[model samples]
Target: MTREESDMIDHRRLGRELDLFVSDPLAGAGLPIWLPAGAAARHAVEEYVRDLERRAGYQHVYSPPLGKRELFALSGHLGYFADDMFPPLRLSADDEFVLRPALCPHQLVYRARGRSYRELPLRIAELGGMYRAERSGVLGGLSRVRAISLNDAHNFCALDQVGEEVREILRLIREAHAALGVRPAGFRLSLRGPGEKYVGDDAQWARAEELLRAALDGVDFTEAPGEAAFYGPKIDIQIVDAAGRESTLSTVQLDFDKPERFDLSYTDASGARRRPVMVHRSLVGSMERLFAYLIEVHQGAFPPWYAPVQLVLLPVDAGQAGAAAELARRAVAAGLRAEVDAGGSLGARIRDAAHRRVPYVGVVGAREAADGSVSLRLRDGRSVAPMPVADALGLVGAVVAARSTDLLPAAA
Candidate 1:
């Protein structure tokens, strides 16, 4: 490789140079390609979030990428999010198809079909690709993208159950963030400005807005009015990056108007039909944006559970190559993402693992080879002390399972 390339290829720069993903103009900008590495990162996050949501009592669902103009008309997306959506494609030269800007509308229809009041609260989650038309010039890295894979969910519940559902969702959001080791920097109660583009009755809007505000009453939040989606008020969860730039990383929005528009209802215990409240949420927002944030935050040193490669075994000599291969096999058997790096100096290989932010680097040199021991070096260069190969593998397995954000805590 050229010296210029080496000098320029730091983590973030290499992330682009290696084609992990790209946001380019020819692709109409703000669109990212999920290259192999990027795809792995995307998959890992999806699996993680899906598992968390499933445990949180959410039922997974998938919907079509494009919804009919009439479907969106019912949800008021045509009136509210028309600017953020792509131009409708003529499906039959008469009818128009709008690339769905959000998943709530379709999910609402799913809820309306033959749902009994017994299903007091239904939480539907989706990890689907959705599109929006961001102007070409505003597109930067993966942080802001046109096409997005969202970890979005919607909760349909009885009016009286709104408060508890909101609290449960917040708990799940906090738990998910903790699991991912992403501590949010700021929280905001996103409300509609008076007489702004906001629709719906003022009293209902106030009640819905108050529900979320009350849920976050004891908690701190930056009050951001006019940022709420036109359909309802919301909570825009923000995170600050290493560069100190703040971005909305997640959201939990409260909706009271759209359900009425769609006439979504459930029979109350008193045998009277009543409208259900809707809650819109996205813990990580889009996979594209989340990946970009993670790359920058960790500087590509992804946690063991999220790292594309968790372990790399380096052989001391050609004779130990077989042992290295065996170690790799064992790692795979243990359900780890591991590989054998047989090139360059032991130090250079270690450096390579460090560069990739691999959680564990295993070294099988002469003494360790004879004793079936392996020297371990963390991405931070701290030695794990040559231990029995089996014990080293166990340690690697534990770290990978824990999904710790930092391999080791910061020194005091």
Candidate 2:
């Protein structure tokens, strides 16, 4: 690869340049601290995902990051995934806890309570924080981390409802990715092969695999044997970034063994007790990984809605500082992220903001102040001169509200 191309894909360097996040030796390897800008972007993503989940009938819940050792044992992680998990912490001779490596076990516990047939297809969502024992050698920037903020959810549905639930989960994944301007290259139908590592019996596995395949009937996918999770078959959505590197960003897994292991049941229409099938879904697997993907894909030019600093107000001179400050306040009041850069030279400030990939740069000068407007410069090199304050607010507010990836309208 050329030097510029390689540099664009190096998220570590981009993260530093954008001041998105930081990693320190004091905090240990594989753990990243999100600075203010990164945190703002993450919060925006979380809010957007939550809104999507809400519209899809998902009920959000908060689960603890750590669980008792026995909890994972009951979920079969002790047998199948012990190496990937952090070592258990011993509280007492009989009491031990471990940080959760996945949110599925706790979600299973949540559905273990009495449930009725009407509640079948119950979707529970969380922006769960999980910890895994990732090897230090394999740790990278945000792409791979010990602590992960997962956009995870689980759907408990009846046997006959599994296909429809999986389809809905897949739809959710596509919609969410599209909103973020990320496109899935294809889907992988990951299934277990001949192995003792898989949890369920052959019959159960066959049924689950069949149902998953049926759900992807018209959709294109490749069968990847041995790539399935120990507990279930899954659809791994692969995305190729602009740099031509591929990664799995979203997944819809059909888990049948966990509910049975946990003895989770719901009363059926005939008043018969039946185990509910669990569907594990992650739209943007983890916020950190998604952020890294976006940084590389867009080359740090985040869309206006997702940009940490959507707009930067630059005063042409010190005399225009008051006008710039007032405009910043107005933008903030309109629910836009704006900041005033009145310190450096006007040209230097504009260049700095552009380098940081701010979506819109507003230059405020005496003429602009007197005209009650600002000269807007877009990231795409399009300049809209003398835009009225009200018009600018309306334009930006609409883009932010609509979550448009394009900075300017088509007509522009």
Candidate 3:
């Protein structure tokens, strides 16, 4: 790649310029502190995904970041994933705890309570924090972090409902990625074979694999033997970023062992107790990694809905500052993120906004302020004709409401 192209896709540099996040040596590696701008963007993403999950009939929940040692032990995490977990904290001889490395165990606990056949295919979701003990050498920007915020969920369903549940999960995955303008290059049908590390008997594993395969019929995916999780088979969504780097961004796994391990069951319509199958899935995977991917893919220029500051009103002189501030207030009231840039000269302020990759910039001078209009400037080097304040607001409001990726819809 050319130097310019290489620099454009460098998330670390762009993150600094955009004031997104920061990592400190004293604070330890792989732990990034999100600045105000970064936090705003993160909030936007979280809200968007939660809305999607809600529409998909998933009930959201908040789980603690730490769990008792016995919880992980019961979930088989200690046996299969202990290497990536932080050391347990011993509060007392009998009360040892460890930071949660995944959300599955806590979710399993939630499902262990009494449930009925009417609640079959119960979907529970959480955008909660998880901790991992990563090697210092592998720590890099947000892509690889010790503290991760996962968009995780689990579906508890009857055996006869597994196929439909998987299909619905896959649909949600596709819709979410499409909304964010991310295209999955392919899928990996991860399975287990000849591995003593896996849980469940051979017949059980074989049945689960067969169910997953049948669910994935008509979908294009590559079979990957031995890539399955210790307890289940999964479909991993592979993403290719603008820099041509490949990463797995989403996953859906079918698990039969965890429910039995936790002794979870629900009463069937026939009045018989039965073990419910569990499906562990992450629609967007790690928020940190997804944010990093977005930064690189869009080159720090986020869409209107996701941009921290959707529009910046630049007052040409101190006399017009009131007008700019009032405009910003109106924009915010209309459900758009807007800011007034009254610092430095007009040229400097414009350049600063451009450098920060703000989607829209409005230059308000005395004449335009008196006329109740704005000279709108888009990120691309194109300027719209001076338009009435109401019209400009309507245009931007439409874009924000639609969550359109197109910055210059007028031009388009």
Best by lDDT: 3
lDDT of 3 by residue, 175-288 (tens): 888677776889889999675889988898889889889988999899989889999889999886656777889999989998889888999889999999999999998989
* Comparing 1 and 2 on TM-score, the stronger one: 2
What's model 2's lDDT at 134?
Answer: 95
* Predicted structure 3: lDDT: 0.89
Clashes of each: 0, 0, 0
Listing every candidate in turn, what is its Cα RMSD in Å to the true structure after a full C-alpha superposition? 3.9, 1.5, 1.7
Highest TM-score, which number? 2
lDDT digits (tens) for residues 128-168 of candidate 1: 87887888676667767788888998888888888888888
Candidate 2 has what TM-score?
A: 0.97
Q: Evaluate model 1: give its lDDT.
A: 0.79
Q: By lDDT, rank the candidates, best first.
A: 3, 2, 1
lDDT of 2 by residue, 1-412 (tens): 7767777668788899899999999999999999999898889989999999999999999889998999988988888889999999998999999899899888854564689989878999999999989999989899889999999999989889988888888888888887788867899999998869988788988998999999999998999999999998998999765456777899988888888887888888899988888899998889988988888877788888989999899989988999999999999998899999988788899889989899999999899988889989998888887889989878888888888888876545
Q: Is candidate 2 or candidate 3 better by TM-score?
A: 2
Clashing pairs in 3: none
